[model samples]
Structures are given as structure tokens and as C-alpha cells.
Target: MQNFDYCTPTRLLFGQGVVEKLPEVMSRYGKKILLTYGGGSIKKMGLYDMVKELLKEFTIVELSGIQPNPKYDPSVLEGVKLCKENDIDVILSVGGGSVLDCSKAIAAGAKYDGDPWDLISYKVKAQAALPIVDIITLAATGSEYDCGGVISRTATNDKIGYVDPLLYPVVSFLDPTYTFTVSAKQTAAGCADAMNHIMEQYFCEDSTILNDGFMEAGLKSLMVNAKKCIEDPEDYTARAEMMLTCTYGCNGIYSLGNSPTGWPLHGMEHVLSAYYDITHGVGLAIITPRWMKHVLSEKTVDRFVKYGVHVFGIDSHQDPFTIANQAIEATYKFFESIHIPMHLKEVGIDESRIDEMAKHVADNEGLENAWVPLLRQDIAEIFRASL
Candidate 1:
């Protein structure tokens, strides 16, 4: 096992009516709130009204319409302006991971006088950030439990993962009821995203047996519960378990004392989402199996064998390569079974930009340090295979 330093400070209130404590949680921060959310889904689900009614006494400054693959240009910039102008004390992000991700960037930017991109791009490290309290409406990304967020700059077609411990939400309200109304497509995509999060950590060079068991169980649980969610969106037990599993996805707890895997699939998929504006989770699903196929070799087949035998319950008494290949096929089929568009072309991405996207990922994503050590040509080949 690898040596590590870890801490998860985000206070979680998870269950069926946790939002009832929203007012009490907000009281610890301040009265002036910078409320951030994506489009109108919150209002449609009546969460917006409930939040307003709960915090009627607070002075709210709204920064609505934070998009997925959260934009750094307008959303982060505008949010900083709102915080500065209004002297916002705390940020209330009441949507999915995208909203919370955007709010995290906004939180850091509000404290710094320089451009937010400086902080996001790591040109400048953040010293402090305004407190963030979130009500998670989706189970993907696990941004509520972690300090990292992926921000996109469309002008340059750049999507960067900005991580700083200062940006962890002070409190996260995770009520599974909030996700009961999630659409089938989104629920599948969210499941795909959370699964990839575990896979990224699981496929590393070194890890504990205990960590592998945790990830294997997480993958199995997500698959079973995701199907149940598709069959019945309001299955409380399924949603609750899926939500809790996902909350641990990106927080590093699942991989404690484990060697870093370089998160190579995320590096490749970030370019897809950055260039095509495709769904983040869908991009991951399309890239994951292909990446797995590309990276499988004598050195890595044992891990795949274990994954296949443990997670998918494939017969382990076969050739190791056969087990590895079977595991990859099973991953692809699961996403397909969930009705995710399992091809680059299915999501409006095509071969035209494949080379360019591949080069960008190769240059910027540091895939050379990945578990499989992919170079430019290797990345391009994986992209073509994914197509």
C-alpha cells in the first residue's frame, strides 16, 4: 500500500428529509446568500420553492443557469461579481454536481482579486474561499463530498479539473427524494459517471485488498441499483444506496493508501466533453472500455481478471486475456443496457476531430504518466477504437 494523507471535512446530512435542516445549516454561514443552480429543474421539482420558503428571511442573490461541464467564462466570472458586489457571505448551490462545481469555482474566485482561471488553471493557488452549502439533486460527480470540480473554457476547448481543499462544501444535504424525479437517461448517465469514478481509482498500479473489495462492491451495487432506478425512479432504497455509493466516488476514500492511476479515462473524456459538449458521463462510458482494451497487457491482466471474476462474476478458470476482454465487454454492455449512447458518433462526436482531440489530450492531460503510459499515437488509436 502507498502512503497517503486524507481528510473528508464535508458534513453530510443524507436521507429522506434532510433538507428540513437547510435553515439551520445556513444559519451558521450568514444571511446574505449567493444562490447558484442550473436551469429550471429545481423549480420544476418544487425544490426551489421549498428552499425559498425555508430561507425566506435570508437575503438571496441568484446566479442561475450554471451549465454542465460548468463554464468558467460567464458562470464563474458572473458569480464572482455577484459575491463581490453583494458582499455575499455564503454560497447556496441547490442543483446537481454541475451547479456545485461551478459554485466551487465561484467560491474561490470571490475571494481572489485576480481572474478565476488563474486559480482554476493552477497559475495561482487559492488561499481562502467563501463557505459553500449545497443540496444535492443528483448522485453523480460527488462534488458535494470532494474539493475538486471540472471547469470548461469553451473558447480554448479546455476542461480542467480544479482541486483545492479550501473549496470543499461546508455542508451537503443529500436527500434521495430529490433525485426521485431524475429522468431515465440522466439517471443512467449519472450511474455511468459514478462507476467510472470508481474504475478510475480501482485500475491503479498498487492498492490494498480492502480497497479493491470496496470498489468491486461499489461497481456491483451501482449496476444493480441503476437498473432498479430505471425500472422505478422512486425506489428509495436503491436511490439512497446509489447516492451514498456515488458520494464516495471522488473523495479519495475508496482509494486511500492506493497508488494513483492518473485517471487516464477522465483525461481522454474531458476532451470529448470540451469539444463536443456531449454529456460527461456518456463520454466516459464510451471511452472506458476502449481505454481498457488499449491498456490491457501481461502486466495488467491480473487486475482485469480480478475485476471480471469479482465484479461481473465471470468464470475465472479461463485464459487471463480472455477474462480481461470479457470484463471490457461487460462494461460496454452495461452502459448499453442502460440505454446510453455507447459510441462517440452516437453523441454527435465524429472522426473529423478525433485526431485533434487526441493530440490535445495527449499534450495537456499528461497521459504519459498514466498506469498504461499512453503516448500521442496510443491516445489517437484509443479514440479511433472508441469511435
Candidate 2:
């Protein structure tokens, strides 16, 4: 185990009808609220009315139409403007991870005088930020439990994961009932996203057995429950488990004593999502197995063997290389079985921009420092294989 310091201060009110506690939670942060959501899905599901009725005593400002990838220009800028102009005391993000992610930027930017991009890009550090509370409707990204979010600059084709301790949500209301209406496509993609989070930590250079066991169980649970979710979106038990799994995904808990892998799959997929505006989790699903194959070698075969045997129940009697290859194939097939588009071309990406994305990922994401360091050529090859 490695030395570490960790804290997750977000108060979680989990289970059905938990959003009814919104009024009591919001009271601690004052009455002026910036309500953030995406695409009006909350309204369609009647969650908007439920939240509004609960918080009827409070003043509210709406920042709607936040996208999946969560753009910086309109969403972040408009949110910041609302916060500053209204003296917003707290932000209530009432949608998926992207809304909460945009709210994080807005929360920080509300305190800063300069452009929010500087803070998001790490050009400037945040000293203070507005308090954030969220009702997560999607199981992906895990932004509600983490102090980080991926933000995209569409014009520049740049997507950056921004993290600051101050960005953690003050409160997160997790009612799995809200996710009961999630589509099969998103449920599968969300599973892929959360699973990749574990693999990112599991494949590291140094780790404790405790963490490895936790990740292995998490991977298995996600794979099993993700299929359940696809078969029946209303399975409360499966939805709750998957939601909790995703909540733990990106908060550094799984990687506490582990050496960093630099999250190379995310590094590669960020370019795909940023360039083509594809779904974030879908892009991750497409890239993960390809990256796994590219990075496989003698040094990494042991990890793959353990993953195959423990997570997939692959027979352990086989040679290490065959086990590793089987594990990679199983991963690909799992995503495919869950209905994620398994190829970049299927998602409208082609060779024309492979070189561009590889170069961009190399220059920006620093994949060369990943666990199995990847050069631009290596990343390009993985991209081609994914295609």
C-alpha cells in the first residue's frame, strides 16, 4: 500500500423518494438556487415538478439544455452568469453527470473573476467555489461523488478532465428510481464507463490486494448488473447497485494505494468524444479493448490473467498470453453483447482524423506516461484497431 490522504464530504441521501429531502438539504446552503439540467428530461419524467414543488419556498434560476459532453461556452458561461448575477448561494444540478459537471465549473467560475477556461484548464487554481448539490439521473461519470468533471471546448475539439478538491458536491441525492427510465443504450454505456474506471486502477504498476479485490468484484458486479439493466431497466436492485458502483468509480477510492495508470483509455476516448461529439461512455467502450490489446505484453499479462480468471471466470490452466488474449476478447464481446457500438467507424469516426486525434491525445493527455506508455504511433494503431 502507498501513503494516501482521502476525504469524500458529499452527503448522500440514497433510495426512493429521497428527492423529497431537497428542501431540508437546500436550507443549509440558503434559498437562492441555480437549477441545472440537460435536455428537459427531468421535466418529461416529472422530476422537475417534484423538485420544484419540494423547493417551492426557495428562489430558483434555470440553466437547462446542458449537453452530454458538457460544453464550456454556453452551459458553463451561462451558469456562471446566473450565479454571479443572482448571488446564487447554491447550485442544484438535477440531471446526469454532465449537468453536475457543468455545475461544478459554474460553481468555481462564480467565484473567479477571469474566464472559467483558465481554471478548468489548470491555468489558474481555484481558491473558493459555490456549494453544489445534485440529483443524479445517470449512472455514468460519477461526478456527484467526485471533485472532477470532463469539459469540452467544441471549437477547439478539446475535452479536459478538471479536478479540484473544492469541486466536490456538498450533497448528492441518489434515488435509483430516477434512472428507471434510462434507455438501454445509456445503461450499457454507463456500465462500460464504470467498468473502465475500475480497469484503469486495476492495471496500475503498484496496488494493494484489498484494492484489487474491490475492483475485481466491482467489475463483475457491473458486468452482471448491466445486463440485468438492459433486460429490465426497472430492476431496482440492479439499478441501485450499478448506481453505487458508478458513484465510487472516479473518486480515487479504488486507486488509493495504487500506482497511477494515467487513465489511458479515457485519454484516447476523450479525443473521440471531443472530435465527433459521440457519447462519452460509448467511445470508452470502443477504445478500451483495443487499448488493452495494444498495451498487453509480458509485464502486463499477469494482471490480465487475474482479471480473466476472477472477473470472467476464464479457465486459469491456459498459458498467460492466451488468457490475456481471451480476457481482451471477452471484454470486447461483453460490450458488444450490451449493445455498445464496438467500432469507431460505427460511431462515424474514420481514418481521416485518426492521426489528428492520436497527435492531440499525445500532446495533451500525456499517454506517454501511462502505465504502459504509448507513443503517438501506438495510440494511432489502437485507434485503427478500434475502427
Candidate 3:
């Protein structure tokens, strides 16, 4: 096992009706609140009224319509302006990961006089950030429990994963009931997103047996429960398990003491999402198996064998290469079975921009330093194969 230092400071208020505790939690942060959300789903679900009723004693400032793959221009900049103008004491993000992500960036940016992009792009490091509290309504990205958020610069077609310990949420309200109304498409995509998080850590070179087992179980649970969710969105147990699984996805606890893989699939998928503005999880599902196939070799076959046997229950008696191939195929089929568009073309990506994307990923994401060390050509080939 590798050496590591880990801490997750977010206070989790989990289970049904936990949002009722919002008033008590918000009291600690003061009355000046920046309420952030995406679209108007919370209002449609009646959560907006409930939250408003609970916090009627507090002064609330609203920043709505935060999009998925959260943008920097209007959302981040506008949020910073709101915080500065209102003397916002705390930010309460009440939506999915994207809203919380934008809130995180806003938290960091509000304290800095410079443009928020400087903080997001790592051109400047954050010294201090405003406190953040969130109520999660989705089971993807795990932003509630992590300090990293993926932000997109639309003009440059750049999506960057910004990480700073200052960005972790001070509190996260996780009521699975909030996710009961999630659409079928998002349910599957969220599962794919969470599963890929575990796989990224599991496939690394230096991993503990205990961590591997934990990840394998997480993958199995997500696969099974995600299907249950698709079959019946109101299944409380399935929604709860799926919600918890994704909450743990990007927090680094599942991979403690493990060598980093540089998360090559995410590195590549960022470019795709940056260029096309497609769904983040769907892009990951389409790229994962293809990247797995491209990176399979003698050095990586043993890991794939273990993945096949343990996660998918593939026949272990077969040769290592065959087992590896079977594992990759099983991964592809599982994502497809969940109704994820398994090809880039199906998601409206074509070959015209493959070269540009590959070059951008290679230049920006540093995939050449990944566990398998993919070159620009290798990444382009994986993109081609994914198509």
C-alpha cells in the first residue's frame, strides 16, 4: 500500500426528511445566504418552497439556471459578483453536482479580487473561501464530498478539474428522496459515472487488497441497484444505495493508499465534453471500455484479469489476455445494457474533431503521464475506437 493523507470534513445529514434540518444547519453560517440551483427542478419538486419556508428568518439571494458541465463566464462570475455585492456569508447549493461545483468555484472566487478563471485554471491558488452547504438531488460527480469540481470555459472549449482543499463543502444534506424523481437516462448515466470512479482507482498500479475489494463491491452494488432504479424510480432502497455510492465516488476514500492512475478516462472525456457539451457521464461510459481495450497489454493484463474475475465474475481459468478482453467487453455491454449510447457517433461526435480533441487532451490533461502513458496518437486511436 502507498502512503497517504485523507480527511473529509463535510457533515452529512443523510436519510429521509433530512432537509428539514436545513434551518438549524444554516443558522451556523449566518443570515446572508447565496442560494444556487440549476434550472427550476427544485421549484417543480416543491423543495424550493420547503426550503424557503424553513429559512424564512434568513435573507436569501438567488443564483439559478446553473447548467451541467458548469460554465465559468456567467455562473461563476455572476456568483462571485452576487457574493461580493451581498456580503454573502454562506452559499447554499440546492441541486445536483454541477450546482455545487459552481458554488465551490464561487466560494473560492468570492474571496479573490482576480477573475474566477485564475483560481479554476490554477493560475492562482486560493487562500481562503466562503463556507458552502449543499442539498444534493443527484447521484453523480460526488462534488458534495470532494474538493474538486470540473469547470468548463466555453470560449476555449476547455473543461478543467479544479481541486483545492478550500473548496470542500462545510455541510451536505443527502436525502435520497430528493433523487427519487431522477429520470431514467440520468439514473443510468449517474451509475456509469460512479462506477468509472471506482474503476479508475482499482486499475492503478499500487492498490491495497482491502481497497480493491471495497471498490469491487461498490461497482457490483451500483450495477445492480442502478438497474433497480431504472425499473422503478421509486425504489427507496435502490435510490439510497445509489446515492451513497456516488457520494463516495470522487472523495478519494475508496482509493486511499493507492497509487494514482491520473484518471486517464476522465482526462480524455473532459475534452469530449468540452468540445461537444455532451453529458459528462455518458461521455465517460463511451470512452471507458475503449480506453481499457487500448491500454491492455502484458503489464496491465493481470489487473484486468482480477477486474474480470472479481467484478464481472468472468471465468478465471482462461488465459490472461482473454480474461482481459472479456472484462472489457463486459464493461461495454453493461453500459450499453443501461441504455448509455456506447459510441461517440451516437452522441453526435464525429471524426472531424478527433485530432483536435486528442491534441488538446494530450497537451492539457497530460495523459502521457497516466498509468499507461498514452500519447496523442494513442488517445486519438481510443477516440476512433470509441466512435
Candidate 4:
């Protein structure tokens, strides 16, 4: 086991109808609330009205249209303005992880006078940030449990995973009922996103047995229940388990005391999403199998074998390489089975920006830290393979 220090300060209220607890949770922070959400889906689902009715006593300053792969431009700038002008005491982010992640940035930007880009770029540390309370509607990202957000700078095609323990939410409300209305496409993509979160941690060179087993169970659960939810959207048992698995993903808890594998999949996918605004999970699904193929060698084949037998139930009688290759094929098939786009062209990403994206990822994402270190040419080749 690796030496580590861990802490999760966010208070979770999870279950059906737990969203009604928002007022009680927000009351502690003060009345002026900066309410943030994405698009108008929440309104269409009647969640907007529900939240409004629930928070009738508090003044709500709304920030809407925070896009997927959340942007730092208008939302953060506008939020900072709202916080200053309204004297907002707290941030209440409702809807998916993007909204919550955007709100996390807003919460920090609200307290800082300098350009918020500094914080996102890690040019400086966050001194303090507004208290954040979130109501999650998406099972992916795990931003609710973790103190981090991935924000995009459109001009630079930079998607950064900005993390700061100072930005941990004061409260997070998770009700699986909220995810009941999520579309099948997004539901599957979300499952893929969460699963990749575990794979990134589990595939690390320095992992312990404890985290590998925990993550294996998580992967199997996601695979089984994701299919169930896809086959029957209203299956509570499947939805609940999928939601819980996603909740634990990307939070570092699944691999607590486990060593880091450098999160190379994320490094590669960040470029796809950052450059083309592709869906994070779908990009991950497209790149993961190809990345596994590229990185497989004597040093990494054993981990692949374990993943095959443990996660895929591959029989051990076959040669390890054969078993490993089958496992990668199965992964691609699983994502395809879920109707997720499995190729870069399928996602509308082509060769136009591959070289640029490869260079950008190499420069900024630290892909070299990967278990099997990937250089710029290696990243470019992986992108080409996905193409």
C-alpha cells in the first residue's frame, strides 16, 4: 500500500426526494444564492420549478446555459459579476456534472479579483472560495464527491482538470430519481466516462491488490448495470448501482492508498474533447482500447491479463497475449453495444487537428507520466489509430 492522506468534506444527501433538503442545506450559507445550471433541460424536466418552489424564501440569481465540457469564459466571468453585484453568499449548482463543475469554478472566481484563468492554469493557488452546494442529475464526472472540475478554454483548445481542495463543496445532493430522465445516449456515455475513471487508476504500474479488486468490482458492476439501464431505463436497481459506481468514480476514493497510473487515457481524451468539443466519455471509449493496444508489452501484459480474467471473465487457458487482445476487443464491443461512438470520425473528429492536439497534450497534460510513458509521437500515433 502507498502512503497517502485522504479527506472528503462534502456532505452527501442521497436517495429519492432528497433534493427537498436543499433549503435546509443552503440556509446555513445565507440567503443570496447563485444558482447555476446547464441548458433548459432542468426546466423541461420540471426540476427547475421544483427547486424554485423549494427555495422560495431565498433570493436566486440564475446562471444558465453552461455548456458541456464546461467553458470558463462567460459562465465564470458572469458568475463573478453576479457574485460581486448580488453579494451572493453561496453557490447552488443543480443539474449535471458540467453545471456543478462550472459552479465550482464560479465559486472560486467569485472570491478572486485577478483573472480566474490563473486559478484554472495553476498559475496561483486558490486562497479561499465561496461555499458550494450541488444537486447532481448526472451519474458521471464524480465532481460532486471530488474537489475538481474540467474546464475548457475554447480559443486555446485547452481542457484542464483544475483541482483544489479549497473548492470542495460544502454539500452535495444525489437522488437517483434525478437521473431517471437522462437520455440513453448520455446514460451510456456517462457509464463509459465513469468506468474510464476507474481504469485510469487501476492500470497504473504502482497499484496495490486492494484497489485493483475494488476497481474490478466497480467495472463489472458498471458493465452489467449499464446494460440493464440501457435495456430498461426505469430499472431502479440498475440505475441505482450505476449511479453509485459513477459517484465513486474519479474521486480518488476507489484507489485510496493506491499508487497513481498517471491517468494517460484522460490525457489523450482531453485533447479530443478540448480540441473538438467531443463528449468526454465517448472520446475516452474510443481512445481506451487503442491506447491499450499501443501500450501493451511484457511490462504491461500482466495487468491486461488480470483485467481480462477479472473484469471480462476471460478463461485463463488461453495465452496471456491472446486473452489480453480479447479483453481489449471486448471493451470496444461493450462501448459499441452501448451505442457509443467508437471511432474518432464517428464523433466528427478527423485529422485536421490531430497533430496540434497531440502537441498540446504533450506540452500540457504530462502524458509522459503514464505507466508506459507516451511521447508526442506516441500520442500522435494513438490519435491516428483512433482515427
Candidate 5:
């Protein structure tokens, strides 16, 4: 096993009716809260009213319309403006991962006098940040548990994953009931997002049997529960389990003591979402199987065989190449079963920018050191295969 150090400081209040505890949690930070959310889903679900009623005693500031693939421009900049202008003490992100992700960037930017992009791009490190507490409505991205967020610069077509330990939420209130009203499309996309998180870690060069077991079980659980969620959006057990699984996805716990795979699929998919502004999880689903097929070889077939046998229950006696190919096909079919667009063309991306996007990914994402070591041409081939 590889050496590792881990800490999860965020307090989790899970289960039904946990939002009632919001007052106590918010009290720990202060009364001046910058409440962040995306669109008006919370209002539609009545969560907004409940939160307002609970925190009526505290001073509230609002920053809404934080989009998915969270934009760095208006959302982050406007959030920072609100925080600075209001002297905001804490951020209460009441939507999906994007809102929380935007809140995280705002939390850090609130403290820094320089441009927030400097901090996000690693040109400078933050010395302090506003405290963050989140009520997550979507089960994807695991931003509530992890100390990172993906921010997009639409003008430049750059989607960067900004990670800093100081950005971890001080508290996360997870009531699966909040996700009961999520649409089937988003539900499936969220499942795909979380499953990719595990697969990225599972396909690394070095890992323990324990880590493998965790990831294998996680993959199976997500596949099963995702279908359940699509069929019945309010299945508490399925939504609850799926929510917890995704919450654990990006926090590095599943791959504790495991070697990093450089998260190659995410590297490829980021360019897609950055360029086309497509759904993040759908991009991942489309890229994952193609990337897996491109990377499978004598050196990697063993891992694929294990994944096939353990996660998908492919016959262990099959040839290693056959098992690997079967595993890849199974992955593609699962995404298609969940109704994710399995091709780039299906998602409004065409051949026009494939080469440009591929070059950008190769140059920016550092995929040369990935587990399978993809170069520029290799990335282009994968993009074409995805098409």
C-alpha cells in the first residue's frame, strides 16, 4: 500500500429533516451569511422557505444563478463582490455542487485583495478564507466533502479544478429528501459523475486489494441505485445510498493509500464542458468508455479483468483481453442505459473543434504522465472514437 495522509473536518448532518439544525450550525460561523444557490430550484422545492424561516434571525445575502460547470466570471466575481460589500462572515450554499463550488471560490476570494483567478490558478495561495457550510441537493461532484471545485472561464474555454484544503466546508447538511425532486436526466448524470470519480482512482498503477474492493462495491452500488433513482425519483433508500456514495466519490477516501492515475478522463472531459458548455457528467460518460478502450493493453488488461469480474461479474475465466473489452463495453452500455448521450455529436459537439480541444487537453491537462500516458495524437484518436 502507498503512504497517505487524510483528514475530513466537515461535520455531516445526514438523514431526513436535518435542515432544522441549520441554525445551530450557522451560529458557529456568524450571523452574516452569504446564501448561494443555482436558479430557483430550492424555492420550487420549498427548501428556500424553510431555510429562510430557520435563519430569519441571521442577516442574509443572496447570490443566485450559479450555473453548472460553475463559471468563474459573474458567479465567482459577483459572489466575491457580495461578500466584500456585505462583509459576509460565512457562505451557506443551498444547491448542488456548482453552487457550493462557486461558494468555495467566493469564500477564498472574499479574503484576497488580488484577483481570485490568481488563487485559482495557483499563482498565489490563500492565507485565509470565509467559512463555508452547504446543504447539497445534488449527489454528484462530492464538493461538499472535498476541498476542491472546478471553475470554468467561458471566454478562454478553460475549466480548471481548483483545490485547496482551506476550502473544505465547515459543515454539510445532507437530507436526501432535498434530492427527491431532481430530474431523471440530472439523477443519471450525477450517478455517472460519481462513478467516474471512483473509476479514476481504481484504474491507477498501484493500489491495495482493500481500495479495489471499495471502488468495486461503489461502482456496483451506483449502477444499481442510479437505475432505481431513474425509475422512482423519491426512493429514499436508493437516493440516500446513492447520495452517500457520491459524497464519498471525490474526497480521496476511496483511493486512500492508492496511487494516483492523474484523473485522465476528467482531463479530457473538462475540455469538452469548457468548450461546448455541455453537462459535465454526460461528457465524462461519453469519454470514459472510449478512453478505457484506448488505454487497454497487456500492462492494463489485468486491472480491467478484475474490474469486469468484481464489478460487472464478468466470467473470470475469460481471456484477459476479452474481459477488458467486455468491461469497457459494459461501461458504455450502462451509460446508454441511463440515457446519457454516448457520443460527442449527440451533445452538439462536432468534428470542427476536436483537434483544437485535443491539443488543448494534451498541452494543459498533463496527460503525458497519466497511467496510460496519452500524447496529443492519442488524445485526438480518443476524441474521434468518442465521436
Candidate 6:
């Protein structure tokens, strides 16, 4: 076991009909509110009307049109303006993780006079942020339960994952029913995303059996429930379990006492999504197995063996290298089985920018601390393999 410290302060209201608790949770944040959401998804689902009705008593200041991968330009700037002009005391994010993530950035920027990018780029620390209360409609990102949010810089092709303990949501309402209408592709992508989250943690250099067990169980749960969900979108039992699995994906609970594994897959995928405007989770799914294959070695082969035997029931009698190779293949197969594109070309990501993205990831991302430290050349090779 490694020396570590952990804490999670987000209060989760999970299950069907948990949205009914929104008014009470919003009440503690204050009267004036900055209601944040994405494009018209909520309106289409009638959730927009429901949330507005529930919070009818509060002074609602609306800030809509947050996008996936959550840009920092207009969205963050507009959000900061809204918070400053309305003197908003609370931020109520009502869509997926994108909206909640944008709201988290807005909350912190509203309290700071410096550019919000300063906080995101680690040039400045967050002093405080407006309290956030969220009603989550998506399960993939885990931003609702986590203190961090990945924001994209459009001009620079940079996606920075900003974390501040102060940004943990005061309350998060998760209702699986709200996710019933999600498209099959997104559902599969979400499952892959959650699985990758656990895999990233489980692939750590410094780990304990306790965390590995938690991560393996979480991965199995996501794999099982996701298949059931894609087959029958309304299977409440499967949907509920999958929702909870994604909810716990990135927060510190599973690896509470373990040292940070440095989330290398996320580091690499950030550039993919940030540059190509791809779905964050989908990019992760495409990149993970390739990263695993590239990083596997004498030192890292055991982690792959454990993951294969535990998560996929791979034969234990095989040589360690063979088991590890099969494990990587199994990961790619899982992504493909769920109808996800396993290659970058399938996703319309051409090879032209591979070198550029590799350099960006190497220079900007914190990959030196990864379980298998990666260099710019190694990153380029992985991107080529992914292509």
C-alpha cells in the first residue's frame, strides 16, 4: 500500500425520482441561481420544464448552450458574465457532465478576477467557488461526484483537466430513468468510459489488493450492465447499476488509500477530444487498449494478467505475455462488441495530426508519473497504432 489521503464531499441522491429533492438542495445554496444546461436535450426530454417548475421559488438566471468536452471560450466567459452580473449565489447544472463541468468552471471563475484559464492551467489556485447543486442526466463523466472538470481551449487545441476540492457539488441528483433515451452509441461509449476509468486506476504502479478488487468489480459491473442496457434500453435494473457504476468511476473512493496512477489514458484522450472535437468517452475507448498494448512489459504484464483473468475470464494457464496480449485484444473486442469504432480512422481521425497531438500530450500532460512513463515518440507510436 502507498501513502495517501482521500476525501469526497458530494452528497448523492440516487434512484428514480431523486430529482424531487432538487428544490431542497438548491435552497441551501441561496436564492439567486445560475441555471446551466447544454443544447436542447433537456427541453426535448421535458426535464427543463420539470426543473424550472421545481425551482420556481428561486430567482433563476439561465445560462444555456454548454457543449461536450465543455469549451472555455464563450461558454466559460458567458458563464462568468452571468455569475458576475446576476450576483448569482448558486449554480444549478441540469444536463450531462458537460454542463456540470462548465458550471464548475464558472463557479470558480466567478470568484476570481484572473482569467479562468489560469485556474485550469495551474497558474493560479482557486480561492472559492459558488456552491453547485446538480441534477445529472448522464452517467459517463462522473463530474457530478468529482471535484475536477476537463475544459477545452479551442484556440490552442488544449484540454486541461482542472481539479479543486472546493468545486465538489453540494448535492447531485442521479435518476437512471433520465438516461433511458440516450442513444445506443452514447450508452456504449459511456460504458467504455467507465471501464477505462477503472482500468486506469487498476493499472497503477503503486496499488493495493483492496483497490484492485474495487476496480475489477466496478469494471465487471459496467460490462455486464452495459450489455443489458444496450439490448433493452429501459431495463431499469441494468440501467440503475450502470448509472451507479459510472457515478463512482472517477471519484477517489475506489482507490482511497492508493497513490495516484496519473490517469494516462485520460491525459492522451484529452488531446484527441480537444483537437478533433470528438466525444470524450469515445476517444478514450479507442485509445485505452492501444495504450495498454504499447505500455505492457515485464513490469506491467502482471497487471494485464490480473485484469484479463478477473474481468474477462482469460485462461490463467497461458504464459504471462500471451495472457497480457489476449487481455489487450479482449479490451479492443469489448469496445467493438458494443459497436464502438476501435480505430481512429473509423472515427474520422486521420493520421496527419498524430505527431502534433503526440507532442502536445507529451509537453502538456503529466505523463512522467504514469505506471509506464511515456515519451513523445512513444505517444506518436501509440497514435499510429490507434490509427
Clashing pairs in 5: none
Per-model TM against the reference: 0.99, 0.99, 0.99, 0.98, 0.99, 0.98
**Candidate 1: misplaced stretches above 4 Å?**
none
Candidate 5 stretches with Cα past 4 Å from truth are none
What does candidate 5's lDDT look like per residue over 265-295, in tens digits? 9999999999999999999999999999999
Clashes of each: 0, 0, 0, 1, 0, 0
Q: Which scores greater on lDDT, model 2 or model 4?
A: 2
* Model 5 lDDT at residue 119: 92
Q: Give Cα distance to truth, residue 180, candidate 6, Å.
A: 0.5
Candidate 3 local distance difference test against the native: 0.94
Error of 1 at 91 (Å): 0.3
- After superposition, the stretches of candidate 2 with alpha carbons farther than 4 Å from their true spots are none
Stretches > 4 Å off in candidate 3: none
Q: Tens digit of lDDT per residue, candidate 4, span 1-387?
A: 789889999888888888878888889999999999998888988999999999999999998999999988888788889998999999999988999888888888888889999998999888989999998888888999999998888888888899999888888888887888888999988999999999988887677788889999999999999888878888888888888889888778898887777788898898789888989999999999999999999888999999999999999889989999999999999999999988899989889988888888899888787788999999999999998
Native-referenced Cα lDDT, model 2: 0.93
Model 2 C-alpha lDDT per residue in residues 1-387, reported as the tens digit of each score: 778889999888899988888899999999999999999689999999999999999999999999999999899999999999999999999999999999999999999999999999999999999999999999987899999998999999999999999999999999998999999999988998999888888998898889988999999999999999889999999999999999999999887978888999999999999999999889999988988888889899999999899889999999999999999999999999998999889989999999999999999999889999999999999999989
lDDT of 1 by residue, 1-387 (tens): 988989999999999888999999999999999999999999999999999999999999999989999998899999999999999999999999999999999999999999889999999999999999999999889999999999999999999999999999999999999999999999999999999999999998898999999999999999999999999999999999999999999999999999988999999999999998899999999989999998888999999999999999999899999999999999999999999998888888778988898899999999899988988899889889988
Error of 5 at 36 (Å): 0.3
lDDT of each: 0.94, 0.93, 0.94, 0.89, 0.94, 0.89
lDDT of 2 at 74: 90
TM-score of model 1 (CA atoms)? 0.99
